[model samples]
Target chain A: MNTIDHHWQRFTLRQKLSRYAVYLVLVLAFFQSIQSVEVIPEFLLDAPEQMGDMFSRMWPIDFAYYPVAVHDAMIETLNIATLGTLITLIFAIPLALMNASNIVNSAWCHWISRFFLVSSRSVNSLVWALLFVSIFGPGVIAGVLAIAFRSIGFVGKLLGEAIEEVNMGSIEALKATGASWMSILLKGYWPQVLPAFFSIVLFRWDINVRESAVLGLVGAGGIGVVLDDSMNLFQWDRVAMSLLAIFIIVILAEIVVVNIRKRLI
Target chain B: MAGIKSVQNRENPFKHNWFISAIWLLVVCYVLYTFNAMDLSWGRINEGFGHASNLLGRMIPPNFSRWSLLLSGLIESLEIAVISSICGIFISLFLGLFAARNMMPSWVSTPVRALIALCRTFHPVIIAILFVKSVGFGALAGILTLIVASIGFIAKLFAEAIEEISLKQVEAIRATGAGFASIILFSVMPQVFARFIGFSTYQLDSNLRNSTMVGIVGAGGLGGTLFSAFQRFDYDFVAAILIVIIALIMFGEFLSNIVRRIFR
Candidate 1:
C-alpha cells in the first residue's frame, strides 16, 4: 500500500510539471515581446509620480465649462448616437437577411454579404471617421456617417445569427400554408427575431454613444472636439470635467440599456 | 370544439400596443430634430462626393516607399498587443475568480466588480491619452491602456462564466478535505477553462485592433505613422497604411478563429 501511494504521488508531480511547462513557454514569449516594446523599468517606476502630478493639475474641475460648450457638445453626442443607430438598423436589417444562411439560399450571395460585413467591421470607426472627414471636410455629418457605417457590420452580424437561429417549425408551418415569401418573412421570422433585434440595437446604441463622444477628436464633431482642444491646450481642469461628464453619461447609458433589455427580453 | 373555435376567433392575431407606437413616434421626432440640427443638404453631399472621388483617385496605387518605417511600426503594434493580452489574461484570471459571487464573499467580490466597471467606463482611447501623459508616450502606454481594457471586458465575462458553473463539482472536491487552492484548481478550473479561452482570444483580437489606434494619440503603434501620413497629405502612404491595417485585422481574426476552434 505504501509503495502504491508513493507511485501515485510521483505521477501527480510529473503531471503538474508538464502542465506548467506550457505556461512557462507562454510567459517566456510574453517577456520576449515586452522586450521589443521597450517597457523600461525606470519609466514604470516614475509613472506613479507623473500620474500624481497630472491628477494635481486636473483638480478643481471646471464647472463653468459644463453649462455652455460641454452641454451643447454632450447633446450633439447623444444625437449622433441616436441617429447613427437608427440609420444602422435601417441598413442592417436588409444586410442581415441577405447574410442569413437560412434566409438566403444562394451561397454566393451569402458569402458576398459576409464579405461586406467583415470588411466593414475590420476597419475601426475612427478610421472611418478619418476617411469621412477627408471627404465631408469635418463636422457632425462626417461623424454621423462614420458611426452609421461602422455599426452596420456589428448589427448585421448579430441580427443575421439571430435570424438564422429562429424556430424553423413556425417558418415551415407558414410555408406549408401556401403563404407568400413576404408573408412568411413577416409572420414567421420577424416575430421570433424582434426581441433579439431590439436588444442588439439598444446595445449597439449604448456602444455608439461611447464611440461618438470621441469622434470629435478626428474633427467629426462631438464632445471629443472639446476634449481634443482641452488636452492639446493643456487645460487639465477642463479635461477633468469632460472626462467626468463622459463617465456619467456612459454609466447612465448602461443603466438605461440594461433596464430596457430586461423589460424587452 | 365549438368553444375553442369561438375563443380563437375572438383573439386578435396581431396585438398592437399604443405604448410601443408612442415610443417609436418619439424616436422619429428626435431623429428629425437631430437631422435639422446637423443642417444636412443635398448640394453639400454632392460636393463632398466630388472631393471623395478626388481623394480616391489619389489613393490608387499605394506607395510603399517607406516600407521600413511601416514594418517597424507594425511590429511594435503586434508586440504591444501580444504582451498586453498575455498580461491582461493572466491578471483577469485571478480577478475573475475573486469577482465571482459564488466563489467569493460579497465584501470581496463587490469591490472587484466595481473596479472592473470603472475600468470599462472610459474608452481605451481616453485611457491611452492618460497613460501617454503619465508614462511619457510609447508602446508602453498603449500596452497599459489595452491591459486595462482587457481586464474590464474579460473579467466581467469570466466571472459570469464561473458563476454559471455547477457548484456540485466544487462541493465534491471540498468534501475530500481539499484546500481552497486545490479545489479551485481541480474543480472550478475545469468547468470554466474553455470559456476563459474564448474570452481571452476575443480580448486578443480586440487588443490587436486597439493597438493600431492608440498610436493616433501618441501612445505608439501603426496609428502614429498613419496619422502623420494623413497630416502630410500623403494620401498614397495613408492608403498603404490602411491596406496593411485591414490585412492585419483580418489575419488576427483568422488566427483567433483557429484558436477558438482548437479550444472548442
Candidate 2:
C-alpha cells in the first residue's frame, strides 16, 4: 500500500500533452468548419432591400389599431396564464405531498407518485398544447390545460423536494403532542414551505405568460393567432409590431417577477 | 405582565382555523366542478384512446422516403441547437457573472438580473415566432430564438449558483494579492463550474427538443416537416418523426451525462 501511494504521488507530463492535443483538434475542427461553410449567400445583402419594400407597404406600425385590440389580446394572454397557474397550484399541492417520501409513509404510494411526476414532466408544454389541441378543438381552454399540466409536474416535484427538506423534528414533536396527521402537516410543514411555494408560483407565472402567446398557433387563443395571421399573409410590418409588443409585455412582467423574487428569496 | 401579554397574543393569534379549511374545501370543489365542465367523460376518453391507437397502428412502418430532406432538417436542427447553446452560454457567462449581487455592484447586477428574467419570461416557441417574424423564415431566426431562451435560463441559474457559493475562498484568493480576474478564475469558477456544466447540458437537451419545434413557426427545422405531416394527417410519418425526436433527446441526455462526468 505504501509503495503504491508513493508511485501515485507523481504527476505525468504525457497526460497533459494528450489533453492539449484533444483540445487543439476540437478547436481546430470548429474553426475549420466556420471557414469552409458559405452560410451567407451572395444575394444575402439584398435582404435589407426586401425588408424595406415590405416596410414601405405597411409603414408606421398602425398605432390606430393598437387600442382596439392589443388590450383585449393582452388580457386574454394574462387570463390564460392565471387560470393555468391556478389549476396547477391546486393540483400540485396534494401531488407534492404524496410524492414526498417523508410525507407519504408508504413505499408503493411514493413510487407511484414519483412515476406520475416523472411522466408528466417528461413531455414539454408545447407537446401538451399540441395534444390538447387535437383533443379539445383548440381554444383558450386547451392552452390553459396544457400550461396547467406542465406546471403540475414542475411544481409538484420542486415542492415535494421542499417538503422533504422541512424539519422532521418539528413533525415528530407535533406527533408527540398527539396531533392528527393533517394537523401536524398544517402546523409543521405548511409555513416552512409557503415561501418557496410562492416563489415557484411567481416564477411559473412569468413562464406561462410567455407560453400563452404561442398557444394560439394551434388555435389555443392569444397573440399567437395574430402572429400566425400576419405571417401567413406575409404582413411583415404587423408581425414586427406584434413582436415588439410581446417583447415589451415580457420585459415588464419580467421586471415585476424579478422584484417579487428578490423580496422573497 | 409583559411576558404574560406576549404569551396570550401568541396563543390567541387570530385563529383563522376555519379559513384554511375553507380554502382547501373550495379547492377540492373547484377541481371536481372543472373536471366535469371540461367534459372529460369516460366514453369520450375511450374514443380518443381508440383513435390514438389506430393512429399508432399506422405509424409502425415509418416510411423514410424523404430521407435526404429529413436528414438535412435534422442537421439544421442540430446546428441550431449547438450554435445557440454556444453563443447563449458565452454571453450568459458574462451576464451571469455581472448579475451575481455578491460579486458585482448593485447597479450592475440589478439590470443584468432584470435582463435575464426578461429573457426567461416567455416560452421559446413564442420567442421563435417573434424572431421568425423579424428575421424571416430561416435557421438564423431559430438560432436567435434559442439563444434568447438559453440566456434566460442559464444566466439566472448561473447567477444563483454564484450567489450561493462561499465567498471565503474568494476572499482568501484576494488576500493572497491575486487580481480580481485571477481570483474569479481560480476560486469562484471552480466552485460553480460543475453546476454551470449541469445547467448548460440541461439547456442543451431542452434546446435540441426546441430546435425541432421551431420549424413550426417557419424558423427552420424538422418541426415544419412534423407540422405538415400533422396537417396532412400522415400519422405514420408523424410517428416516425416522433420516434426520431425521442431518439435525439435520449442521445442528448447521454451526451449531457458524459459532459457532467468530464466536468466532475
TM-scores vs. true structure, each candidate: 0.93, 0.75
What are the clashing pairs of model 2?
A: none
Candidate 1 per-residue lDDT over residues A59-161, each given as its tens digit? 9999999997899999888888888889888888888999998999898989888888887787788888888999999899899889999999999999999
Candidate 1: tens digits of C-alpha lDDT, residues B1-264: 555454555766657768878988998998878778878777888999999999999999899999999999999999999999998999999999999999999999999999999989998999999999899778999999999999999999999999999999999999999999999999999899879989998999989888889898888899899888888989999999989988999998887786666555
Over 4 Å off, model 2: A1-59, A105-115, A174-188, A255-265, B1-14, B17-75, B95-122, B133-136, B156-184, B243-247
Q: After aligning candidate 1 to the native by TM-score, how far in Å is the CA of B155 from where it should be?
A: 0.9
Question: Per-residue lDDT for A52 in model 2?
Answer: 65
What is the TM-score of candidate 2? 0.75
Scored against the true structure, residue A71 in model 2 reaches a CA lDDT of 58
Model 1 chain A lDDT-worst window of ten: A6-15
Q: How far in Å is the alpha carbon of B166 misplaced in model 1? A: 1.2
**Poorly placed runs, candidate 1 (over 4 Å):** A1-25, A40-42, B1-10, B15-18
Q: List the residue pairs that clash in candidate 1.
A: none
